[model samples]
Target: MKLLKGLWIGFWSGLILGLLLKWIQSVTGEQVYTLLLNVDFVPVIGSVQWSEITEFIFHMIIALVIGVVFVYVAKRRNYSFGQLVLISLLMSAPFPFLYFLLSWLAVEAEVPAATDWSAFLYWIFAHLTYALLLPILYKTFERKNAVSQ
Candidate 1:
């Protein structure tokens, strides 16, 4: 049940985040991601070319891990569903920063090679959206659980 919950949250949240980010990029005329190779001496440590399908897969995987970890941590803390959602969102706050740093390092083993504030803003909005929706989803699902019980 917990695992299922995690996967559900992950899939939906990831899709929402991805779409929102893309939309924001389109509207702002800013690119959310940059090919590190194009930046400088940023050898492609790893690259996921911006394909919708590939992006979906990657988002799903990352969100799944995040959701699982969030639920596990929340359970350990004995938090209510609402509380868990909030905590999980807060916990995920650092993910964007970490991702940015790792991305920059992976590309060029240095900072400032790819310092896109838009990416950070995109991540913030996406994460916040996930956080906001999570509690609502939890409540909806919890009602279902109650009915089943």
Candidate 2:
């Protein structure tokens, strides 16, 4: 049940995050969305021409993994709403830095350059947005789980 809740939250949050990043990129001409969906650095996966939907599914799969782990920890620790939010934010803090690694690894990919301050800021914003959703969605699902259980 907990796992199912986590998956639900992850699906919605990830969808929103992907759409938000794509929208931001469209409006501002930033490549943060490109970074979000880029798996071109992977040995075999990178070689395949993935459509936008496939890339989004890959992104959602990552979010689902994080969600399950996050919910499990939150339930175990009995974290307050504030704690959940804080932990989610902290967990996401390192994500923006991944852009640097991605830039280096996926040289042929159309992601933001390692030194692009503006794109980094946009990435930070997108991540923070996603982090905020985690706790809220978790709380919502917790209520439903409690009722159903």
The lDDT of each candidate is: 0.60, 0.88
Model 1: residues with Cα > 4 Å off, grouped in runs: 33-51, 76-78, 106-119
Evaluated at residue 34, the lDDT of candidate 2 is 92
List RMSD in Å for every model shown.
Answer: 4.8, 1.5
Which candidate comes out best when scored by TM-score? 2
TM-score of each predicted structure versus truth? 0.69, 0.93
Backbone atom clashes (below 3 Å) for every candidate: 0, 0
Model 2 agreement with the true structure over 13-127: per-residue lDDT tens digits: 8888899999999999989899989998898889999999999999999999888877887888788999999989887878877878887787476888889999988888888
lDDT of 1 by residue, 61-146 (tens): 87777766655665465567778666867876775675465555554323322366755666567668877666556556667888
